[model samples]
Target: MGRSKSPVRVITAVVAMAALVLAGCTKPGPSLRPTATTNPPGVFGPGADGLGDTYYPKAGNGGYDVANYDLDLKYDPPTDTLTGTATITATATADLSRFNLDFTGLKTEKVTVNDVDAAAEQSGAELVVTPATGIATGAQFVVKVTYGGVPKAFDEPGLGEIGFLHTDDGAVAIGEPEVASSWFPVNDHPRDKATYTVKIAAPEGLAALSNGAMKDKRSAGGWTTWTWSETKPMAPYLATVVIGKYRVKESTHDGKPMVIAVDTSLSAQVDAQMAQTPEVIDFLESKFGPYPFDALGGIVIDDRRVRFALENQSRPIYSSAFFEAGEDGTWVIVHELAHQWYGDSVAVNEWKEIWLNEGFASYAEWLWFEDKGEQTAQQTFDNSYAPADAEMWRVPPGDPGKSDLFHESVYTRGAMTLHALRVTVGDDAFFKILKAWAAEKAHSNATTPEFIALAERISGKQLDQLFDDWLYGEKRPPRPRR
Candidate 1:
């Protein structure tokens, strides 16, 4: 995600920043390793409510690993209602008679487990489901939930209003840390990544956009159904659906599907900026190995409420504020597209390790500017380090508390950490460590320690003290020296 409500140029001078339902048998894919233990053979127990994330303990559920989510949804713009059926395919990691899905707002009309009617009740933001029968460890089961209502956005303390936002012409489902629950039943954390098949039914004239390749689109009656599929395992937060009137442009880039959508109300300059999508991807690919997804594109929304741009897997969504006054917002584009390699493809194991996502992307912005001959990365790092704020040095980027997750220190200092490492290890090993990290941790979740280990291994340097000082130290450390 990019910085909140700031122009790319202003933010650069300051600091670097920061779903459908369906019920069906999803193809078997990679599953998150279960964090909970199995019960006795015949014994049954309820799945844990949360996945034990340090920042948000109640964020994701435990005891099952989700493989896919098939969402068939219909939205009425005039009435602002969203009705949908979500089919989740998952494997029981333990003996479970009941499990929990993180969900909010909508009224659940019905729920079925493995085709059998199951009892479900909404508790706070969770949908507690009691299966008719017990599921053994390693047993795959399908959960179908039929629900509908006016979706509501989550007003987090520091994160602001997120989740589902009801717009004028349509709606947008986007957020970080936890947005999936506001729209669909989900595991809700990066630890449990899954494939997605979303079928959205919207008014015929409006375009519905989502992640990955478009599978099918057909209009019947007054509504058009847009079907999209993402075969690559993706974190729940990375899944998004934007519905509204859009000037949609579809093409192919490097043998991959490219779909860019801009709000119809936006200026032609926005379209021109969107045209730079492929160029940014090619530049990022050269440094980060191949692009990780099958599709590439972006969605530029015209809502002032959405102040930040998010790296939503294959297709990212940007706020129009980035391109105000026809400014070149390619730096923000680079920040988000770079996340296709760091944050989206290689997600953080826990929210605390967000620097793994924000840091690398911030560094990518510096790299892009350096490539353009505007400013070298070393120079950018020096600028950020020169007048470092006390708060920035006080709050460690490695473990910024939940409230300070998107704080300036996380992006600015996080990128500084990488530059410091680059200075320590030299360019050859630095770039090699980056490519190797992307290749090794592709389509998976990782942690800061794991990254430090990878950097040490690839560069053949002891980097613990370096990482500790830059990532965790409360005081600013001395500048890097070879």
Candidate 2:
């Protein structure tokens, strides 16, 4: 969160645009269809994934079951509808409630649990389904959600960009996690994460691709069904899909295949804007853990207008607009890709800790400059925050009891806390702490105290005052004389 982002501003952003796109799923608008911008449905025409497949329950699933999903959906473009189900398989844990699901804008015409009808309710944009027969430990159950709608510009309602913005040119949805939910049902938040098996049915000549390696694509029934899947579990915010008349630019990194997907209409400018995506990927691979997913690639949505780049799991969403600014592309790309390790893989327990996600991502951006063998760490540190602006780190925990949910306290100050720790704990332990954080908490949410404890354990030094001064304290320490 930036200083410009106040709590009132965030509330307005949510109230204005709550349901928007992220990556895998889509959200509906607050309008009555026909009169309002309603989502079209029932894209199931031919060559569907067959009703046998079951969809995974994202949040409300009973028990603490963590498993990957194999989603097979069938929908049509002409009717602006979808007609296919999903097959979600997972292990059920004892300590749990119902799992949450992100259904995007799809109006649930029908839902079944283990082939039995499950009752669903429409609260706001989500379709809440309480599973029947309940769930037990080690038990496996299948859920299927079916519906459809026109894709909203992949964005959240409150703070949104012109998603699928129509320039003098064509349209592409290039925002982050918000966009995915615009057209599909998925897990809305990051805490509960899973792998995705994506299949999109579009009219002929339209191309579709997602975060992972391409399994198979076929054309039939006057529509083309493109199916892609990821091997690792990713946040719902990172599971992405890019649909357009796209041309694929393929490459390889560390023996894995990569692609830069550009909509055919925008091919002329691809050479200029996307030229550095591969380079940025190479830089990130060297610093962070290995590229998070099996494949590395991106979908070019807006040629410009986007401020932040989202490391949408494997399929990163790039802004066509920022191609002209060399520094903008450098910082945003590195920031988002760093999320591959900090934000994407090891996520926040709740939305309040979004700073833990974004701040670290921003830190990763500065670190990118350091790794380029150009800037000094102190120079980068100074560049990150000037003298008086250091108060950014004073934000309280998002526990609601502690501090505001979002404030510059999270981003600038979050990074500053990390920087302050680096100064206090020394470089060796600091870097080791980071790697240990990633290695230990992969696929789980992390809190500020958890990070603090890890630092103390690794450095063999209790950082009680350091933690207080940097993280929990109400006032920031005076800036060290430059």
Candidate 3:
């Protein structure tokens, strides 16, 4: 994900003030403690309500691994209602009497576990399910939940609004950190990747766009159901559904499906930017190895409220603001598409290592410009290093706390870290490290230490001091040199 560049001091101050005002506004979800059950003593216990993530502990449920999500959804624009059934296929990782799913806002009409009626309850954002029979470790189970509501965005204090946004004509389901729970019952973290088949039913005239290749589309009565299947394992946050009037272009690139869409309300230039999808992917593949997903495309949203472009799997979603005023937003395109490898395919194991996502993508933007003869990467690195942004340097990109997840250092300084490695190890070994990392970690989760280890193995260097200074130090390190 990338936000439009703004003044550093202004953005930081605004975000800081927003955090203060919104502090303690949102309530925490229930604990992940084992709940009492009427099964054999100590044999069956409730699954933990949350995964023990360092930053967002309650972000995902524990004790089960999701395999696939089959979502059948219908939205009525006039009434702003979203009704859906989520059929989740998962395998229990431990003995369980009951388990938890991250969900909120919507009213659950019914729930069933493995074709049996199951008792369920909603507590805060957690949907606790008690199946009739105990699910043993390694046992596969199916959960079907019928639910509906007027979907609402999560109004995070400093982060702004995210999740399901009821738009003028249709709706958009997208966000970072946590958004899937607002729309569907989900595991809700990058650590648990799963395949998806999304079937969205909307008014006959509107377009409903989603990830991967379009499987089928049919119109019945006054509604149209659009089916999309993302066979690749994708983090829950990368799944999105965009519904509204759109000018869509569908074609095949290199024998793979390519679908690009722009809101009818935006200028034609947005479509032009969207047209650059194939070219950008081709360029990134040369540096990051094969593109990780089966399909590729982009979505340019008309909503101005969306200030950033998210690297949604298979298809990245762009805020129309990026292309406003006839600005050339190709760099934004490169940043998000680069995430197809760095962020989407090889996701971060923990949110703290976000630079693994943002940094590599930001560096891709520099590489793109250098390829276009606009600026060399060394020049970009020199400029960033020369600057004395104390706040940026102080907040280490590798461990920027939860509040500064998108801090400037995470992008700019993070890129400089990569360039420093290139300068230290030379171009051949540097590119090799990148390609090898993508190839080995494709469609999986990774971390900074893992990346550093890969770099060291590829380059034959003891680079602890370099990573320590660049990624963790509170003060800027010495400039890079051969």
Candidate 4:
């Protein structure tokens, strides 16, 4: 939960600070191996469907295959009342009659396995089921769980906790776990991402929302039912739910629909503060390709989300951090949107190669700056920021043995590595290399070495030394003459 609690909440911020300094660690499951065809000797592609595929063969009994979900959930901030139902479809990777799903704050009232009441066990937020009939390997089944509780959190808040505290403000779903199942039955982690069809029932006039698109809505029992479906497969952390007294702001950018939902305080005037989004998106599409979703918009929630933005699919959760007037936001915004291609669509195989995401997005920012009258963009490349010492390459971010995703070495030196690549390949071919890299591997993870290979192959130029010196091994290149 890389979110930092406020100074007022300093005592409550035990794990927040540590988590921020160390961006946590998340690894994809083993089932994520590329199809034999897509798996090249030196490269592998993303999930079959683009959203990441996480498989933990030994995490549970026989492992689990999370296919999809029909999630119907609700929370009453009035009494901190949490209630919901989820129909989870999954397959048994191996022969097994029982399995577990993480649900931190949520309580289970009823359980059904394939349309029949079944014996279930509840331990903390985990729900385990013993099917009446032994389920076989690769056999698909349905699990319907209905329950509600005061949504709780894990040992860490933002990383694996589901925040469902009923507050004076409203109820919000801050899911980062393969742990959101505490509030809803879910596979939890990102590599296990699946198509989610969510339904939320809340008091009328209160806005109910979830990830993806809003399909249908109706009032039931003085509570409004919200049906949201994201056909795109998504990890549980990315599967989000938020309900509160909202101020919805609507606008159109480059012909695509855009919406910004905030609390009542800024609902009426959220647009003026977030006006820069369209131009930024247009600028990106002109270079990177399309926006990479059906629509694009922002969700500037309360200050609790801390710094930066969570690029949550078509709708990213932006904190008040970027709402300021004329900050150095161009770099940050471009970085997040570029995640639509790098981190979101084509995710990393594991936490170790986060440089693949951060570096590419940061370099995209420089490319945007270069487009914004920075002398042909190559000057930005020429001025790649780094220490002159050859040894700087060896000292990457994170501790010597422990890797951190946001270390300055990874940020600055990582960006500079892209610059060094451009310098090696020349301008015209450099841009072509980028376009080809993005186009060919549009929705899959790419390793740093794999990227180097793609470029080396395309340019017919050797790149082992480029990746070696700048990325894996830290040795700054020779300083340019003044």
lDDT of 2 by residue, 37-93 (tens): 111232211111111101212332223333566656544444444446565655444
lDDT of 3: 0.82
lDDT (Cα atoms) of all candidates against the true structure: 0.84, 0.55, 0.82, 0.57
Off by over 4 Å in 1: 1-32, 37-42
Score residue 136 of candidate 2 by CA lDDT.
Answer: 51
lDDT string, candidate 4, 452-472, tens digits: 778887777887776676776
What TM-score should be assigned to candidate 4? 0.77
Model 2 lDDT, residue 160, Cα:
51
Model 4: weakest 10-residue lDDT segment is 15-24
Off by over 4 Å in 3: 1-42
lDDT-better candidate, 1 vs 2:
1
Task: Give the alpha carbon lDDT tens digit for every residue of 81-165 in model 3.
Answer: 9999999999887789889999998999999999999999999999999999999877899999999999878865345788999
Q: In terms of lDDT, which candidate is stronger, 2 or 4?
A: 4
Backbone clashes in candidate 1 total 8
Q: List ranges where model 4 is wrong by over 4 Å.
A: 1-62, 122-126, 154-168, 175-182, 250-257, 267-270, 325-330, 374-384, 387-403, 442-446, 474-482
**Model 2, runs deviating above 4 Å:** 1-66, 74-83, 94-104, 130-132, 151-158, 161-182, 265-275, 303-307, 325-328, 384-408, 479-482
Q: Sort by lDDT, best first: what order?
A: 1, 3, 4, 2
Model 1, range 286-342, lDDT digits (tens) per residue?
999999899999999998777788889898888887787755677778888998899
Number of the top candidate by TM-score? 1
Q: What local lDDT score does residue 43 receive in model 1, on the 0 to 100 scale?
A: 82
